[model samples]
Target: MKSRFLIALALSALSFSAFAHVGEAHDHGGFLTGFVHPITGLDHLAAMLAVGVWSAMTTRRLWIAPLSFAALLLGGALLAQSGIAFPAIEPMIAASMLVVGLLLAAQVKLPEAAGAVLVGAFALFHGAAHGQELADGSALAGMVAGTALLHTAGIAIGLGFRRANQWLPRLAGAAVALMGLNMGWSLIAG
Candidate 1:
C-alpha cells in the first residue's frame, strides 16, 4: 500500500515537469500550457498541496479554504507584478509547507477562519513566485489561471487521499514538510 502511494506521488511529481514552464521563452498557447505551471515546480506543488491537506484535516468547510487560497494567490501575483516586495517570500512559502504538513501529520484542528488566513498568507508568496516567472504581457492572465488550476488539482488530490485513509493525510503532510525543510535549507545554504 505504501509503495503504491509512493508510486502515485512519483507519478504526480513527474507530471509537473511537463507544465513546469508554462510561458517561458517558448510560446505554446493552449489550456494545458496555461494549467501546468504550479504543479511542475516542487516548491509550488508542496505548498499548494499542504494547504489543501491541512485545510481538509482542520476545517469542516473544506472548499472555502482552498478557494480563499486561490483568490489570495491571484491577488499576490498582481502585487508581485506591481513590485510589492514581500520579505522572506521564499522562506515563508517553505515555512508554510512545513507548518501545514506538521499540522496535518499531528491532526491538529484549528478554526476554519484561522486555517483560511494561514493558507491565504502562504498563497500570496506562492502567487508572487509564479508572477515573477510570468512575462509582462497577455500571457500573464493565462499563466496565472494555469497556476490556479494546478493548485486546485493539488488540493483535490490531497483531499481525496485524506478521505480514503486517516493516516494518509499525516503521511502526505510529513512529505510536504520534509520538502519545505529541504527548500529552506537550500535557501540558507545558498
Candidate 2:
C-alpha cells in the first residue's frame, strides 16, 4: 500500500510542468484554468501542501488549517477581483512557502486557532495573486476546489510519511523550505 501510494504521489507530482507565472497574459479563462493554476505554480503548490502536512502532523483536528487556508484564499481572490490591492503579494506568497515549510520541518505545534490564523493570512495573499488573473466566478470556485484537493493530497502524504518513518515528513518540509528560499531569491534577484 505504501509503495503504491508513493508511486501515485510521485507520478502526480511529476505529471505536469509548471505553467503559471505572475504578470503573464493568460488568454485562457474560466474553471479549467483556475483549477490548474495552483497545481501548476510551484509556489502555490508547495505552500498548499505544506499547510496540509503541517496541519496533519501537529493538530488533532486535522481540518482546521486547511479549512482556514481555503476560506481565506477565496476571500483574498474576491478582494482582488474587487480591485483591492494587497501590498507585497509576491513576497508574502514566497514567505508563506518559507514559513509553512519551516513549520512543518520543525514540527512546531501551535494552538489550532493560531495555526489557522497563520495559514489564513498567507492564503489571502495567494488568493489575491491568483484571483487577479482569473476572469470569472466559476474560476474562483475551481481554484478553491483545486486548492482543497491539493490539501487533501498533502494530508495523505503527511500521514503516509508519519506512518512510514518519523523523519520523512521533516525531510519533505526541508525540501519545501529550500524551494521557497530559491523562489524568494529568484524574485529578489530577477
Candidate 3:
C-alpha cells in the first residue's frame, strides 16, 4: 500500500509535464488526440482507468464494460454538441473517480445491472467533457479517437495485470482515489 501510494504521488507530479507536451507534433492525430486528452487531465485519466480496473475486477465480460462506456460517452458528446447542460459536470467527473476507485479497492461486488448503471452515469459525464472540448474546436475527431484508444489500453492493462497479481487492482484503485482527491482539491481551490 505504501509503495503504491508513493508511486501514485510520483505519477501525480509527472502529470503536469505530460499535459505540456500535448501541443507537440505526434503520430496519427486521430487516436492520439483522444488518448492525450484523457491522460493529460488528472481527473479524466484516473476515472477512466478506474473504470477499466474495476471492470476487470468485477466482471468476466471485459469488452462489454468498455464498449458500454464508449457508446454512452459518444451519446453524451452528442448531447454536449447540441448544447445540453449537465450542471456540475467537472465535479461529477472527479467524484466518479473517487467512487469507482473506492468501490474497486474495497472489492465491492455489485450486481450486473447496478454496476452498469453506475458506469453509464459516469461515462456520460466524461463524454460530455470530451464533447465540450471538441465543440470548442480543439481537434475533435482525433481527440475522441485518442481517448477511446487510451481507454482500451487502460482496460487491457488492467485485465492483464489482474490475472497475475490480485493486489494490482486494489493498488490501482487507491492510486485513482488519490488522483481524485487531488482533482477535487484543485477544483475547489481554483
> Which pairs of residues collide in model 2?
none
**Which sequence of candidate numbers ranks them by TM-score, best first?**
2, 1, 3
Better of 1 and 3 by lDDT: 1
Q: Highest TM-score: which candidate? A: 2
Task: Report the lDDT tens digits of candidate 2 across residue range 1-190.
Answer: 9756754564454333232354553534788878987887877998899999899999999889999999999999889878888888887887888799899989999999999999999999999888778878888888998999999998888777678776778767776776666667767877
TM-score, predicted candidate 3 vs. hidden true structure: 0.76
Better model by TM-score, 2 or 3?
2
Which segments of candidate 3 are over 4 A away from where they belong?
1-32, 136-144
Report the number of the highest-lDDT candidate: 2
What is the lDDT ranking, best to worst? 2, 1, 3
Better of 1 and 2 by lDDT: 2
Clashing pairs in 1: 34-146
Off by over 4 Å in 1: 1-34, 136-140, 151-155
- lDDT (tens digit, per residue) of candidate 1 on 64-130: 7777778888788678778787677778777877887788788888788887888888888777766
Instruction: Tell me how far the alpha carbon of residue 14 in candidate 1 is from the true structure, in angstroms, after superposition.
Output: 14
Evaluate all candidate structures by whole-model CA lDDT and list the values in order.
0.68, 0.82, 0.67
Clashes of each: 1, 0, 7
